[model samples]
Target: MQTGNLLLLLLVMIAGAYYLGHRRALILARPLGGIRHLHSLPFYFAMRSAIWSALPALLVLASWLAFENSIIRAVVVGGMAESAQPADPAAMNLVISQIQNVASGAIPASFVSQDVAQAAEQLSRLQNLSGMAMTVVVLVLAMLGSAWAWLQVSPRMRARQKVERVLQTIFMVCATLAILTTVGIVMSVLFESMQFFSKIPVTEFLFGLQWSPQTALRADQVAAQGAFGAIPLFVGTLLISAIALLVAVPVGLMSAIYLAEYAPARVRSFAKPALEVLAGVPTVVYGFFAALTVAPFIRNLGESVGLSVDSESALAAGLVMGVMIIPFVSSLADDVITAVPQALRDGSLGLGATRSETIKKVVFPAALPGIMGGILLAASRAIGETMIVVMAAGLAANLTINPLESVTTITVQIVTLLTGDQEFDSAKTLAAFALGLMLFITTLVMNMVALHIVKKYREQYD
Candidate 1:
């Protein structure tokens, strides 16, 4: 049976177990004057049965699926000609890929040796046999667990405690999985970045002015050990992000204040959602708007005023990026502003303060921390944006603050460096990991700054 079909079967069996367990609990209760005779609720008994029936079968299925490929590959490869034995890791991987491709009919068997063709046939047989065995074993274990759990459903059983404990364990397992996944990502990037740093000095990467990552594929090629200095990328990222924040923060904040404070119920209902619709618009659509409409307009206006504007200026990209992130600021700020204590506003009014005065003195201060959070969130969004910038801002890693000039961000360069087929061992490809690590650190610092601001404002309000 296919894995998906087996999973469906397991769920069906679990449902049957739940029904049987619930019915049994009710039958045991009826003779003793209703459900009050039971130790716990009938639902708890049902859930305990369902958990037992599902968990063991899932474990078996998961384990089989995990090791099936490697075990099958080893068996198939063992029967091939002695000359077919892989001499290295890369060769072994290539052989396994080709074998799987032939088995899947992605590659013709006639193209390979008779030995390899036979191995592919063996692989196919083993895969089918493995699937059949897994289906049988999993279904049998599930039934066994279901029968065991159903038999244990009794007037004396602490069904609620058992069910609760099982759920708690499941939650902890999920949380642990999340933490492990995060650690795995960080370690993967860190190790690759270490490989990159081995090839290029840390100081040169951090402080050098040039940002080219192209490397010569041949010894006789003209490409000089392409400069790895990352300063230009950092400067471009900051320059564009600063422009985006300048455009986003004030406009979004004022919109939030007006919506939360001055707008009527009807107006707020329509306007808030209408503004948020901008957030749902895809970033690529914004990129098109910037590139096709905004960039050309900016260039035309610049020429009329005797100023130079690149056809793909940072100004156009930043403006559109700011529009895309407005909802992040407005939505968060509105919630916090509306949450300010009514008593604070009343007290300010009692002290002869007007509506504007109450807003400025009593409400805004209380909401400052949340507003700060919203702006910083927008700033981070600006920093991490790639699609809009890639489409609108030309890929020129120029270290200048001029908004009318074209520039590229670290993310753009990372994508550029790793776009086509390349060797992972090459510095050009490894440089992407280093750029990713630096981006991670930069955002971490930004988060720290946001937290500090939030704490400062929170204390004043408290």
Candidate 2:
């Protein structure tokens, strides 16, 4: 059977088991008055039976799913036998691929040999048998679990509490999975960055002011010593993000204020979603617009004012990014502002404060923490943005703060470093990981700070 079909079958079997268990539990509880005499209703007892029956089988299925591929691969490798093993890893891998193809009925006559043919036949038979055995075992275990759980149910059973605990465990497991995924990513980046740091000194990378990444692959050729100083890239990121924030914050906050405090329902219903359209525009589209349209317009405008400006400038990219972030800030801020207790605004109005005065003095302050949190989140997004800066901001990493001049960012640098032909162990490739690590840390810190502020604000309000 296909993998998807197998999975669906497993799910169906589990559901059937749950139903059986639930029915059995109701039957067992019936002599003692069943659900009527229990602390929880009959359905809760059934639900508890169903959950207990399904969970163990589900855990087994999950474990099997996670490890099946590796186990199968190892078995296949070992079954190749000593005589068929290739001396080289690459050659052995090629043989393994051919064997797998033959087993799967994908290999043509050109690749077939007697030994390989024999191995393929054996592998196919083994796989089929193993799969059938596993399926039977899973179904049997599910049935046994259902029967056991069905016997456990009684009139005195705390079914509701048991179900709640199980649900809490499931939620905790899901939360742990998310946290572990993040931790895994960070660990991978950290290890790769360490590999990079070993090749290049941390002091030189951090302190050097110039930024050039090109190096010769040939040993005889003189390679340029790459200046790994990240200051310029960071500055460019900050400069562009600052400009974006300047553009986005005022507009987003003002729009949010109008929507929350003054705008007619019809106006808000139409305008809020319309403003969100800016957020939906792809970054690549924004990149070209920044590079081709916005950059030229800004350069022309700068020239009219007798200011020399690069065609690829930080200002253009920043402006677009700011436009991109406005909806994010405004939407979140609007929700927070709306969530503020209406009593505060009513009290301020009763004191003779105008709508505008109440909003400014009472509503905005109440929602400021959440608004700041939203802005910080937006800032994190802007800092990590790659395409707009890559297209509009030139690669030359100049430390100057002139928004009209060419600039780069950490994201752009990371992209350039890792793209095309790359050796994972090389310093250049490792630099991308190091940059990723730094970027991750920066965003993590920002998020934590935003969360702290929001939590404190929530505590105050509560």
Q: What is the C-alpha local distance difference test score of candidate 1?
A: 0.92
Q: For residues 403-460, write the lDDT of model 2, one tens digit per residue.
A: 9999989999898887897878667678889888878888889888888887887777
How many residue pairs clash in all the candidates, one count each? 0, 0
Model 2: which residue pairs collide?
A: none
Distance from true location, Cα of 231 in model 2, Å: 1.7
- What tens-digit string does per-residue lDDT give for candidate 1 at 41-129? 99999999999999999998999999998898888998788887788998888888888889999999998877778888999999999
Q: Which stretches of candidate 2 lie over 4 Å from their true place?
A: 14-35, 81-109, 112-126, 216-224, 303-308, 394-398, 448-462
In terms of lDDT, model 2 sits at 0.82
Best-performing candidate as measured by lDDT: 1
Candidate 2, poorest ten consecutive residues by summed lDDT = 33-42
TM-scores of the candidates in the order shown: 0.94, 0.86
